[model samples]
Target: MKDGEGHISIYIELMDTSSLPTGWTVTALVNLFVFDQIRDKYYTVPAQYSFTTDYSLVRFSAVKLEWGITSFVELEVFNDSSNGYLVGDDCVFGADVFLIKQPINKVNVLWMKLYPKGNGKVAGNNISAYLCLDNLTLPSDTNIFVKFSIGVRNVVKSTIIKSTSTGKHHFDYLSPSVGRLHIYPNGNKMKDGEGHISIYIELMDTSSLPIGWTVTALVNLFVFDQIRGKYFTVPDYSAVRFSAVNLEWGITRFVELKVFNDSSNGYLVGDECVFGAEVFIIKQPINKVNVLSLSGEGANHLTRTHIWKIRSFSSLSLDFYESVKFTCGDFKWWIKLYPKGNGEGKGNSISAFLHLDECNLPSDTKVFVKFSIGVQNVVRSDIINSRAEHHFEDLSLGRGFRKLISLNKFEDLKNEILVDDVCIIQADVSIVGIVTTK
Candidate 1:
């Protein structure tokens, strides 16, 4: 009940449950409480009762409530243990409630594949492919603006080919492009019946841009020369319109290109290579959109060491297995060790590997980590090391150096890899980057 003076009364009803099991009876003391949204806390109401019997109407009055703001309420009940009614393995019930409703936003993900439609050979530069988005669902009248790229996988590690605004370039390595290639979702310049992909880019509303300034996008493409390890610029650099109005309805466009072989220009790697690309908002006058980095970008590296004192290592009847668990870059990891070499190195060397504990990680996530598995010299200060960088996705959980150390060399006291009965292993882990995709 609300009065004209801005004060209202709230009521809660306790339904009668006399129809419960023949001998069942609820006998508990209950309390009432209210929540203050503005204060982020709960205030107990001055109401307590011994609910031996249920009633239809329980009313509360003189509650000071905000006129237009949101609020919450809660109800609590306690069992009076001293009373014989709530004993002998009886259960108590309570409830938690909220007043206002919040809105939710959903995200969509798109996957695509590329297929070569020409002669199935990239040699001599006649190779072309139809890169299409296989499955996508969008609301009617919705537009999408997107930037697409195609390049070799792990380019940073190989450095065989470089992609830039200017085009593809060959650095210190004379990247022999087995052939140059282009990616096209839908294009009239080249005929590819293989597949089709709906391409779109998403741009944030500029009306809310920092200080309300507008920005546009300039798009370009770079094709890769596989063998030569270089990139050739594809024609057609176009500027697209971007505005606050288009925030809801973006630009919808398609891409397709033709690749010409440039072996004469020293651009040919081989018949096969992996490629990737990035499409994003213009980053010139805007100074790039703000991003929060949880860990240092590039190479945020850390190391961990473990020593295993195996008094019986020399007398072991069979191969010995051991492992250690540690944390690096906010991720749980483990070191798997084998005293007797595994696989081809069995009985000849020691094997070690790094494994990721998938317990706390999200499904289908990508984790990039670089690390080294090494044996620490126990007698002298030396480390036998094996270093590698890898991309660990949902499917890849562990990687390692199989033949880390030779057993004969390990037993040699002069080598110092092992002293007395203790063996030392070290893992230097560097988390370069992490990406969570929806």
Candidate 2:
């Protein structure tokens, strides 16, 4: 049949309905098709419908035995020569019917949660809801399209407090996690003043966790130095506890904005910077105490200075050179220098490290020291130095700065760091404290 709007429809009509049983009804899956001349295929439209007698038509001595699509195809499309529906004034139309005694059923499951106290930035002021898909039950590469609605009812008012329908969303393996890093380039006013950047690691929906649950972890934040290819690490000396009341922990003044934005610093290059975090959860912390005794005030606390002079410094070609062992505190130490820098600072700066000789000390002993290492400019009496405090043990034998001094400044004739092919490096060591577990 053809409609007034120039659309043709197909219908299935049962003949001789008088032979059917009383109050008869049948359901069928139907497909209407048109022949494609060029492709030699059929363009089919499939649908399901139940056919029953129409009592109104029965009163007029007729039976309503027709049920099918009302808009199968437009007349213009069916007659178009390019569509291959009609070729040389000849076309074919047909239908296929699959009778079904019972309909098949399928079920899809999804998990959802509602937070009356809100979550994330909207916590304590608004309500939020989230839907989760069960990935464990599905194939690894499966993708799901979802549309859902969430509503909260006000029982006292007999009305909906809020109702919202989020249209369609695609879910995949790369979905966002509940923990995120919050960075404020201009600094967080509540935590820090201006001229600095603030960073925090936050657990988004802490209210969803089990009661009295707490997580203790050692967190370290880092800013990448693009030019040096290394990270400036800011480590937390102690473990931080995260709970429902306390959702985040971080540095209020991570880095001064001026220092981070400076091009020479290699931090904010090309208007981009990288920030990351390392969180090590302490699953079973040991219950132990450490007592430290420093040796820098009394007779035994005298500072020790070691000056190592290298002849033919310009002729040294090794990647690294180590000074002879020197006495510091109760342990022996040495100075390790990379003439052309090392690791991330290779070819750009001079790298120096203080190494502890752990062979003589007890296997479990840890030594804490504060030391300064420098290259002396003999002509101007100006020293380029780097100072740090570190704990040295069997596992951690060395620690120092990679970019100690730029090669340009270190080798400049005016700096006189290297004079007449001779260079001198000095180290000042002091025993800060020692950590020994009982």
Candidate 3:
């Protein structure tokens, strides 16, 4: 710091604390100058300050003195200051220290737009924005986390609309390389009844930040102006800046201005408008987070057949028998044959049945299956067919006909029904529907 009779000089320097926690960096943007009390003028340095290292230095010399005899020197440091510091009659020196460096974790503004929702029977409308980041490295062996909210404010109104709503839509990113987020303001409060609105996006978070660095984020917002037929930003409010340590940052409050939807307001073009946003993330640290991989197999269709040739037809061991088992539609089934026939057709006809694997179908659930079973006449090339179609719940599991074919017809040698003292049988199975009862 230097002072003289008719002028003043200010010198600024930075020092890096190597002991600072991870993700934390040290730097400052300093504007050193002499405010003229009498001339009402500011004599500032010729160029902006740039601090890239711990030993960086900036000097402002010979700034013409203010108030003639009594003057004061002002120093200001900030990450962003697009809005002039002169508010009303007071001089404001605002500072935003971005301490975090993101080399791997990249944050960006994906998209923003205004959508209209009708009133009355229709729902209210709103304006929404999306935020995304790629390659976010979460610390391993520790549950390190961060939380923040996005916000929107109308340039035409004087109220700040925080984008943090419980109903705000959020998506869990399954990809290991990227994270996506979105938020929308209540439409009813945003759009003019005629369908025109102006809004901007902001970020806010009070969650813990990584060690060693301060985090600073810059987001740019724009609105389509109907009168000018181009995108325009409200002066001094086009960019939102956030500066914080892990878990120590807060949202910057904003005021809204009311712009009517009518032509006189000059914001809407036939009840439509467009909006957009962009974000800048800065940070430094080497860490990693896990990304999950998901996959599944598709459904399949299959068909199978089983055959049983019965020998010694005159000396059968039992009245009824079943063929070898086959599988289809994830279940086991078989064709059953009763050479002597059953029920009303006893000793006169051959019976055939289709049986389902009892253990495969859950007893607590209802299952529907369709199948056909039959015995083939070897020489005649004709089929003794039996069809079964029913709901096989916990009760019934099998379907068949007592008299699938007459004994005389099955035994006839001219038709070759009993060829070479051997009989052949086959069956077809398919699952059509399955439902679990409550």
Candidate 4:
């Protein structure tokens, strides 16, 4: 009620039943001095947009929804976590934090298969990644590395991306999480498609060159080899312009960053965002990228010791081995023991089946084991039994030592239980089967 300004407020204490309107209507009833007779609650809501809130909110307008400014939205998003997430689809831990910086969430659909069209668009045949909701943006002239996780088959070159836009700033980053960008929405060169991701990056800002700039990012469908072979170079790229821009480090203001899947197979995009280029405030330049180490390295055996003790079973150590430190080529290392359940370690007592596990091992690989051999049980004092056990490699289908001489007995003899005997059989790899002798 202000001085005669028709701007008076109406107070309607409508208890909102916090539920989305599926098929609900609003009925309003009020009485006034102008009305002659007492009126019933009049309900007039034909087609209203449904909205529900989980907090205090006041309606400033009944129809056009003038929700009194509060730190809350009158809506709830029940997202199916299975079918990936869209842009702006976030999980806020503290209720309200989107005011400072743009909050981000990532959803990935790995190993998506697709067939590319030779005409230029990357076919969404096995379209693994989709930004459903309001389409996500892939910046223009953005020199980013977008990698797909494809396997030893499937042509990423013939692939293209098809998506609706959010009207503005709709760019795509296939494998780019780092560097320089020049391609814009209207540019038409770096639009989201298949065969290869094409974009440009900014190298020179103002008059100074980017001294600390280098492109580095982990991409999907791209292995170390594929990256080495393709994408790293955009043909004849010199400046950020129409078709393909040349990308060398400091020569041009804009450079094109390209990525192509050498082995058209399925690959999972790892969720670690690397920079298009890491800029350092340096006077001159720094170092080149780090050199690669051991290629396709198998396991480097750590504690290669055999089990030789009370025979019934020796508890395997679980503390020392949390994860497998060595690689097992084609076969897995399954360190077994006797008495079925004696490997059960308890506290410090050797009783638990302590082990490290690996799931992504290659097929047809096996592990050889060695034992801790000490003097006491056998005819030779310098040696316990046999360094004497025999073993051979086999091309069998299953894992473990192809040809091995396992102790084959939980207790070889009654007195063989070594209450007084002191011995330790040392071997190379952890034997799959526990070998014991009297």
Q: Taking the candidates one at a time, how many backbone clashes does each contain?
A: 35, 0, 35, 93
Off by over 4 Å in 4: 1-199, 202-338, 341-377, 380-438
Residue range 1-438, candidate 2, lDDT tens digits: 245367777666756767767767654434567778556588865321101111011111134567656687889998889998875455668776544332222224567766789776867997877665554554443445554555677899998743322223333332212244667889999864478888777655444446777755445567779899987755332245677777687777788999998989988889767776654333433435575776544736436888989878878899999999988766788999998998778999888888988776776678777789988889888777888766677867887767888888876653376677778889988886777764
Alpha-carbon lDDT, every model: 0.43, 0.66, 0.44, 0.26
lDDT tens string, model 1, 1-438?
233233223434435544556544332222333333223244433321111111111221223111211121211222333332232223222323212111132223334334444333343453332223212343322223333434446756874332221222111001111112334344322333233321223232122245445443333333456556765432322233345444321112222222332344433234332332222222222233322233543323334454444554556555646565777766788877777877766788888778888885776566677788888876668788888765565556777766787877776743475466566777888775676654
Off by over 4 Å in 2: 1-288, 299-302
User: How accurate locally is residue 9 in candidate 1, as Cα lDDT from 0 to 100?
Assistant: 32
Candidate 3 C-alpha error for residue 162, in Å: 53
Compared with the true structure, what per-residue lDDT tens digits does model 3 show for residues 226-329? 67666454332121223342221111211133453445545445754444443344332444433222122322343445667777776786978877777776
Whichever of 1 and 2 has more TM-score, that candidate is: 2
Q: Positional deviation of 355 in candidate 1, in angstroms?
A: 0.7
Model number with the top lDDT: 2
Error of 3 at 169 (Å): 42
Stronger candidate by TM-score (1 vs 3) = 1
> Whole-model lDDT, candidate 4?
0.26
lDDT score of residue 413 within candidate 3: 46
Residue 374 lDDT, candidate 2, scale 0-100: 88
The order of the candidates by TM-score, greatest first, is 2, 1, 3, 4
Q: Score candidate 4 by TM-score against the native.
A: 0.20
TM-score of each: 0.34, 0.35, 0.31, 0.20
